[model samples]
Target: MDTLIFVLFLYVLLTIPVFVLLMLFAVLTRSARLRRAAEVVSLSACAALLVLTFERAFEKPLLWIVVVLLVAVLAFGVSTIVKAARERP
Candidate 1:
């Protein structure tokens, strides 16, 4: 129980930055599709984060999977922002 709480605390901490960066990209880019896609994904991630918060048992290695997914999302946003900047008129 305590362990799950700690993991969730960390997840929430990590989620904030990822969400912020995604939101920034959505706001800066003129692509409505990109913004909509990002919003859906990020919101779903938040829902998953909530589910993980109450988990009392699981393979410990799942934490690594969670971190990887979060990082991948952040990396995708970074790539999108870079591409948008380069392609701007």
Candidate 2:
């Protein structure tokens, strides 16, 4: 569990900066591909952080909230990825 948490923490830490940079580049260049990449990265980072939180506080009432949020984020991520794939040239 400790190792899992550490890995997730590291993933979030690394992806967040990449997400931010992708978003900035997308905005500057008006690139849809970059924007979608940024969205995926952001969602992945959010889900990782949420999982880390959920693991650390599994016994808390807040666990339910985290679970709900994690589900929502994952669902949204899947839907967006599918949509992007369908729209690909």
TM-score of each: 0.40, 0.78
Clashing pairs in 1: none
Residue 73, candidate 1: C-alpha displacement in angstroms: 22
Writing each residue's lDDT as its tens digit, candidate 2 over 1-89 gives 88888898999999978988999999999998899899888888888887877776767876778788788888988897899799888
1-89 per-residue lDDT for model 1 (tens digits): 66766776676667677767767787898666566566655655555564563252255655766656656665676677668768877
lDDT of 2: 0.85
Q: Which stretches of candidate 2 lie over 4 Å from their true place?
A: none
Model 1, residue 66: displacement in angstroms?
A: 25
